[model samples]
Target chain A: MNGLNGIGVKVVHVGGNGNAHAVLREIEARLQLLVEKGEEGSIDLSGLPLMPEDYDLLEETLGEGEVVAEVHSLGPTRIHETGIPGVWWVTHYNSDDEVLAEFIEVAWCPEILLTPEDDVKDGLEALRARLFELNPKSPLGGAPSLDL
Target chain B: MRDETLLDTLKRRGISRRGFLKFCATTASMLALPPAMAAEVAAALGKVRRPAVIWLSFQECTGCTESLTRAHSPSIESLIFDAISLDYHHTLQAASGHAAEEAREHSMKQDWGNYLLLVDGSIPLKDDGVYSTIAGISNLQMLKDAAAGAAAIVSVGTCAAYGGLPHANPNPTGAVSVSEIIKDKPIINVPGCPPIPAVLTGVLAHYLTFGAIPDLDDLGRPKAFFGESIHDRCYRRPFYDQGKFAKTFDDEGARNGWCLFELGCKGPTTHNACATTKWNGGTSWPVQSGHGCLGCSEPDFWDGGSFYKALSTPISPVTGAAAAAVAIGAAAGVAIGLANRQTKAAAKAAHQKATIADLEK
Candidate 1:
């Protein structure tokens, strides 16, 4: 019990616009209750008890590149339901730094998984076969159109 | 001799053809070239006649020469000088006095605008270049004379590149690099205390095969060797990023092989491939062997700072020990009280033992 310090991860968010104080306050209130109950170790913001409107409040305050959240995983807490094995909480904010965009990317992990040599060959073959069935100059003939 | 192949020359010198090929492979790897390039290097080297090279030594300790000749792996003398037609070297040439000078003169004249110039030290430019003399001529005049008809120049050590030890603070003789004086010819700087022998041979091989100097950086150094900073390729860089530093030589940190960032290692700022290429065939670099890099290759690295101080941290105590002692005693009274009691009992026992011995005498 002497060194039961929780591990907290600080994430510096960049990009997006708006004030972050209100979103921060709401997160603090929710986290404070969890801390009091000794359940503050691993938080699932994706499963947060708060309303979707409240989550929207957070989204509204965030600008791109802003630090929208900090995750704190209490030493003893276990997060069984969220599928992630670790216990952590995220505190969010908004900022304007650019390098974090790679980390912020929506399709980052999927891109990493699909960009390997075998995957690239599979993709190229699919594209090549699709080309025979379509008109060369038509926008939607070879592949899905940009609008869709 | 004129028509001898490189393999035949090596065999004549008792170095096996396979061993000579291994040397070429080692050279290609050292230059960071692909493995496929090794056979091309060997083939190219075998066909060409040895290019004429003239060695010159100026204001130096001849450590470069010592390092070059002492290279036991490939033996710099055999791989470098013998591979090339070293027509005139002051230390190695048989001729003496005016005759030696005359040989150097003849080589430059006969191979005019074709011979390669290898300078081992800096040229003193102050006081009409009277500081360093060779054959009754200042280094400046000799440099001007040699560089006049040379095809290319390779400044062989730190002295020839950044004006080594002689150019430290209060450099009285105004020791300047070869480029500072000889600006006409294409110069390639190979800077180190005594640069790695493989790097030296690699550059020479590149020049021989291509018939022109290799790609150079802004400093006139080859990009293949000097492209990245030492920190970028250092094995201990992960430890540095994690902020795990060795504070002392014999401490637990040092024993764990932690990053030497706290020990004034200039690997972060200095650019060289020593961390990867290493000395004596990838055995170890200075930081790997427990000593920090002193940034020996950079200009004015000798006077930068102490080798053991952290590059960014504060070394001295923020507050005095007396103040810390009082504060610690006040804050942790029980711990201090127990320590003081143990000290007093130990001192009292020693004192009483001394007094009893005096009384008995």
Candidate 2:
């Protein structure tokens, strides 16, 4: 049993069609392209006709890396780097913790991890509002010093 | 009657930009579109208002509705329902009697020529269509009335698409498909005993994203889901190619996961996304569970033949002929080789005699 977004999921292993090697070859090619062109690329793992065994094979071969994260949005999105430096595994799950999409991205960082410009702008305004509410009139012309 | 756009609704529900993006990517993948198209889908879906949808059920077993509702919550498939204002459905609606009929009429009058019409099960035509009736209105009359104002009609199951089980052998009520009755509006046929939930949602997503129906095959099915035969995309195809087959349910081949073609697997001719998209949220489909395909998506599958009988001939007759030709060609090559050897041996003997005579001279 594996827990995703607080939901217990039973993972069942099944047979494959021997396409895991082909997918590995594709990843290698994509990695090479990333190296030569300095361009990012990704493969939609959910779109492929891969079985549980194929997924297991890919996971075993890729192993694990240092970085791992969980982004809570609609539900939860898990993103982790594989053993390879540039390869990342990203999975998006719905509120029920069912996998909505999965991808193998070859890039410095997956796109979903980046904070949107609008979000940053909103965050700045929110922080300013909260600070003003905390100290409407403080020393140094309404700006409180960190030493306080 | 929510006035907010889809994006607004998602935002109100606390879904972030990343979540929406993820939903769009999943939608694109479900529709078999490239990942890049997810942006386009997002742009279109974000601003689009919910379209009014009217679901009409006739001679059906409620299987299609059951199949659709089985889609996991908060999933993209379920989100499609949130994207649409479902005005009327006998099974899912809260209203009934005249009130139920009133909602259907109001939706037609309010969103006439724009509302999407979804029909399941066949419509009986014989005997003045008295076999089935909703709110005292006959199935035939109700279909014609509803179809008149619908922008387009989606025949959800094999029944509404190809006159399914109700129109099987004997076809007591002389039932016919929606296309046989409604001619003006464009109809998308999603034929299956009960279609995959994602397929119906994919069609809806394509329509919602592009404001037009997706590319369809000759049978009016979305080509994205019906383009490839199950056998062609099946994991057991290699077994079929190697002539490995499962003869009985308990046979060694069956236990070893061999091809089910000899066991009346209709995957070779039946086209659907089951082999890839799979059923029960990518868990398993019939073939994966060690059962032969029933060819449920094809037209007239009920009367096609026995489910247990093997296909009369190989999927492609030419394949059998080619195998026979290869064998005959191999035999002919051996015979020609023997003849060539004999000729070479005789020529060598004659050359020896000639050389001896020359030496004597």
| Model 1 ranges off by over 4 Å | A1-148, B1-24, B75-80, B313-361
lDDT of candidate 1 over B99-126, digit per residue (tens): 9999999889888888899999888888
Q: lDDT score of model 2?
A: 0.85
CAPRI grade of model 2 = acceptable
Off by over 4 Å in 2: A1-15, A138-148, B1-3, B313-361
Residue pairs with backbone overlap in model 2 = none
Per-residue CA lDDT of model 2 for B193-233, tens digit only, reads 99998889889888877778888899999999999999998
- TM-score of the second chain in candidate 1: 0.79
- Give lDDT per model, in order: 0.64, 0.85
DockQ of all predictions against the true structure, Cα-based: 0.01, 0.32
Worst 10 residues of 2 chain A by lDDT: A139-148
Best by TM-score: 2
